[model samples]
Target: MARSGNEQVSYRRAPNFLTANEPEKRLDIRLSYKSFRALEEQALTLYGISPVEYSATDSRVTIYTAPTALHGYSAVNLQQAISFAVYNILVQHQKQELFERIVAVGESTYSSVNDQGRRSTKTPDAGLSYYYDGGTVLTIIMEVGASEGYTHLNADILLWMNEFHCRTAILFYNKECPKFKFPGNADTYSINDRPALEHTWFGTLDTAVLEVFKRDQNTDTCKMVVQGGSLDIGLTIGDVLPPNEDAIQDIRGERVHLRINFVRNMLASGSHDTAVSRFNHFIGED
Candidate 1:
């Protein structure tokens, strides 16, 4: 349970609302690959991590060696670094359009508004989102790992995406595997432009690839599954593990935590005010 002033709210039943006062302040963090790397470096340094131990060659950075499982800063904080880094990269690269279009709000704030009217504020351990240039469209989601500190809110994430009409959602877990029910469509489109069905996954670092595959088994409903490791190894040329039974423990250990950083993507294109207005218009907010 989370407290707001004198009100006590159940963490599971809170409402999600947009609390940005100017709407302009909402798009502060624009994300880009460059910025993401910088943030990763910053996080490593802050956490006493060494670049020598871990290499962030590109957008999809990973740990080279394994560490003691489950030893690192708060999962929430690590993910926040990812969210901020992604934003900084986008803004610094003058990828302002992406930055302005996408925004990062903490999971706690998101939960408060999601339930609305009926309750007080509730904070999720960690949460994030990427909105379309018009703000009306929520394009991406990042749900950081919380298997140990809190209950995994996989179902709630799905509910929020469906409710908000978000196109893509990503769930990052620390010490556990998350299952999704992805429903596919026969109609194909641009990689990023496809319908909401394709962009959902329970991302993890313990896996071989930077990302895991959660392909939808059905089209009419939200039915999907995870292939093997938390990532699809075929996409990247990096070395991938062949599926060890202790994979989760190996990655969740202390060393790997120090060896890795995360990335989030944000997008937008226009002036700050224009971006704000466009976002407001897209979200249908007065």
Candidate 2:
């Protein structure tokens, strides 16, 4: 029946029997190991991305953010640009062996078993993995952040060392964050007795560069370079990012470039020494 515009509306409706007791009947489904593995494989095939966490004992599957946020920065894009620049430099130097040996993986999950006999996973911001003796090893793990909360990051690095084992780990942060404290200090705790390389980026108009040299007594030398510049979306890695305010539209895009060089000497055999260096050249654009 039709009613006039001024008629009062009825506020009654039939109860929905389907949803009345649905919450009580909801099942807490847990995945099995085989099923979880199968699902993970399926996901890898479809998405080509690593699973966040795949536990076999408890058969638990957990997903986490792949490329973690960096507060006010484009962490993922910066990571990619750095990787691309490094790759290009490696290729240019004709260091095919080292080039193929070191692979850059961004936010890839790695599985491990802890001392508590629990399966765990870690996703570093970026990892430089080296392959040797039919096994893959992480050469360095890099963590970029806007803050100085190193507790979790240090714990994860230690976990990676114990589980997968690596040569070293590095931490990069904005200058505004708290300074990194060295191990054995009164205010800091050690992470497996290994000291991580900590580098800070100052976002001032003046560019800053840091160089780290690692010498293994008399056998080899490794050098790492870290350079900071102002934000410029028009320029990428290997392109000189200007430090002038006029070059940047968004301040959040401010970035740091990293490069590594390795040199090996055959002094024992009286042979010539070989050196391979990678550098990211920056050319300012108008």
Best by TM-score: 2
Error of 2 at 92 (Å): 6.7
Every candidate's CA RMSD: 23.7, 25.4
Off by over 4 Å in 1: 1-94, 110-123, 129-139, 145-152, 176-286
Alpha-carbon lDDT, every model: 0.31, 0.33
Worst 10 residues of 2 by lDDT: 273-282
User: Tens-digit lDDT track for model 1 on 46-132?
Assistant: 445576664322112221111112212333443455445445444554543544433445443443343555443333333444444
Which stretches in model 2 have alpha-carbon errors above 4 Å?
A: 1-93, 114-116, 132-134, 175-286
Q: What lDDT tens digits, residue by residue, belong to model 2 across residues 1-286?
A: 0011111121011012112313111111112223333543543434333444322211121121111122213234444555565455445555334445556676676666668997665566665565556776655555554333334444444555556554344444332223211112212312332222231211221211111111112212222333333222222211222123132234323333432321111111111100000000001010
